[model samples]
Target: MKWFFKILALSLILQSFQFSDTNESPDLITSAQLETKKLEIQNYINSFSCSESGGCNYIAFGSKPCGGPKTFLVFSNSVNLVHLQEMVKNYNEMDNLHNIQTNAISDCSVPLPPTEIKCVNGICTIIN
Candidate 1:
């Protein structure tokens, strides 16, 4: 009987913290949005001209790229797409690169472009 009461109390506590999901849309990235994001990235790359004997490293918390520190131009052939999505799982319910939705307002400004963006490598990249 003690165990039963303990279980009931725990259940009630958990239920009190639960929130309704109605009237909210999932903020997952769609194919069309992804394509749009890609185009935006390409445009940023062109504007910065990072490929023409210029090298820059971009950080993507999820698939979205966030610009890190910049250095002098150097020769580099390929762009690195490091998937830091797992590292960003804690922010899954927040906006930007992780692309999740919740009632919580973001404390950090990870610009969700196409929603919000910032200059990375002298180019604008979506915050994720």
Candidate 2:
């Protein structure tokens, strides 16, 4: 009984230690950061999807709906295979980053605080 109580108390102490009140909030991303994020999103779309045979056009941008790629990036007749491959890689990286970051920032931490914070232009406004 004594050992069990000691273990429970230690667990609670450890848990509370994990929660720290930050004196300063995390720096909100700047306008440049937002633009960069948008560009990354676009680049990710362009990269992940590629063209197929028979001059198939398969672009992976905005890939959520899984639309087919287009015939040509440039108006020229032939295609750029090397560029497509690089785009595919870039898309994969961006897709992964977006997913992870989005998941982390979605909703809020546990215990469900009654307040909410909305952010825009690197500023956060708390709302009831």
In model 2, the runs with Cα more than 4 Å from the true position are 1-54, 62-77, 104-128
Query: Tens digit of lDDT per residue, candidate 2, span 1-128?
Result: 99999999999999887766778664443435544754754454334322222222333331121222211122111336566557555554554454454542323322323243333232222344
User: TM-score of each candidate?
Assistant: 0.28, 0.28
Per-residue lDDT for 76-121 in model 1, tens only?
2243332222323322212243333222233343533233334456
Per TM-score, the best of the predicted structures is 2
Model 2 weakest lDDT span, ten residues long? 68-77
True lDDT of residue 60, candidate 2 = 35
Model 2 TM-score, all chains together:
0.28
